[model samples]
Target: MRSYRAQGPLPGFYHYYPGVPAVVGVRVEERVNFCPAVWNTGLSADPPLFGVSISPKRFTHGLLLKARRFSASFHPFGQKDLVHWLGSHSGREVDKGQAPHFLGHTGVPILEGAYAAYELELLEVHTFGDHDLFVGRVVAVWEEEGLLDEKGRPKPGLALLYYGKGLYGRPAEETFAP
Candidate 1:
């Protein structure tokens, strides 16, 4: 067997590949923006909390702070191209208002083709290193019919998975339960 190690800070350290991609939607009045993010996850179950780590430099960062709410949408693997396109562009330069989206109960934009979406109300912001964690309490949720089983597990659907850099992947077609 062979192994490799790094002692100092690793640049472009995306060793944690294949993360579920989430399109974070934010709106400030008439302006709307969606940022593709992989650094997001469910934080709590009782209070139903979700968090997304975003760099302050991103345009959506300021909008999210001002609006005090946002929506997280998960598109299927077939929409991987759209996900990448949204992430590559910035709201400051490009106007994504024309994108196909509908406002959630909290007024945050939800992608039209998203299989699942969550409307969140901002609860707290924790700064860690280069990014700030925007923690939000899940206020409303929308899920496509027949996507999840009784246990809330996906039923043979391909989820968008990011592999860092400019790559994407999908899970295998096999499922196991014990």
Candidate 2:
């Protein structure tokens, strides 16, 4: 195999695709919005911190800054269309209230039928390049009944994985011990 040398600028940054897409929900006053976030991860174990990076131009960015709270909902692979729709559309244009969701412990909308959902209180906001990383402290979690095994791992459902460029896929159900 051959490798290429570095270039002045990168074409795109999604070589790291196939990550579980998160539907981030935020509400400031009565204005609630939902947006799909493919760039989210756990930041810390202690204090239970999580972070989702959002571009400043996105509507969710401002709402999150004001609300200072959000919910991250993870649906099954079967709901991939919903995930795509949320990402493709803008909250500034669409109502987004038609999506099936309910209020969480902190009053943030949590998507209904999610395999798992997390309610987080905003802890800090860090600016990195064009995106702002909204760091949050996990305050509550909702897990679907019977979805997790005794070890607290999700059973055999396919996870909704984003592959960038409007494509989506899922991991095989087969599991192995490392």
Candidate 3:
């Protein structure tokens, strides 16, 4: 096994760690909910599986489990206000779908400015320590035209990347050349 430098575990260490930020949206009946998530990734290519790790204490957790499906938004950048608003409140108390947010083709709510979105069907749920890992199969996807270039690959610019301690940033504009 390869070994790497170790940083002592600390809360919000993710604030200094670079990672993509994602917003997960789901609706239960007439109520819609949203949450900011960074603990997610594409798990497979053949079956098109993805996974998100959420703490059980979050209201969005129950919603996702009950709904068995959800829409996820991956933003390119510049929506800090909405991200802060959604992350600061609980869905039970606030209706995040009230304005600006809309439902997708799969009936799941999604936020505007999300350059890429995916509607997923829940496949499995497993408890791992303090968080539950949810695996989903992609059923549908919607991406903004600009996100992918003419050849069909992601273009790098203004994509939102987060560091755990309430900080966010975008990739630098071509600081290097081939």
Candidate of highest TM-score: 2
Put down candidate 1 lDDT per residue, 35-85, tens digits, no spaces. 988999999998999999999999999999999999999888889888898
Better of 2 and 3 by TM-score: 2
| Window of ten residues with lowest summed lDDT in model 3 | 8-17
TM-score to true structure, per model? 0.93, 0.94, 0.87
lDDT of 3 by residue, 41-106 (tens): 899988999888889999999999999999878887678767867888888788887747778888
Residues 1-178 of candidate 2: C-alpha lDDT, one tens digit per residue: 8567657555667878878888999998988889989999999999899999999999999999999999998888889888898899999999887888999988999988788899999999999978999999999999986766777556765578888889998878888889
Clashing pairs in 3: 14-164, 15-163, 15-164, 15-165
Clash tally, candidates in order: 0, 0, 4
What would you estimate as the lDDT of candidate 2? Answer: 0.88
Report the lDDT of model 1 for residue 104. 91
By lDDT, the better pick of 1 and 3 is 1
Candidate 2, superposed: residue stretches over 4 Å from native: 5-9
Q: Give the CA lDDT, 0 to 100, for residue 46 in model 3.
A: 85
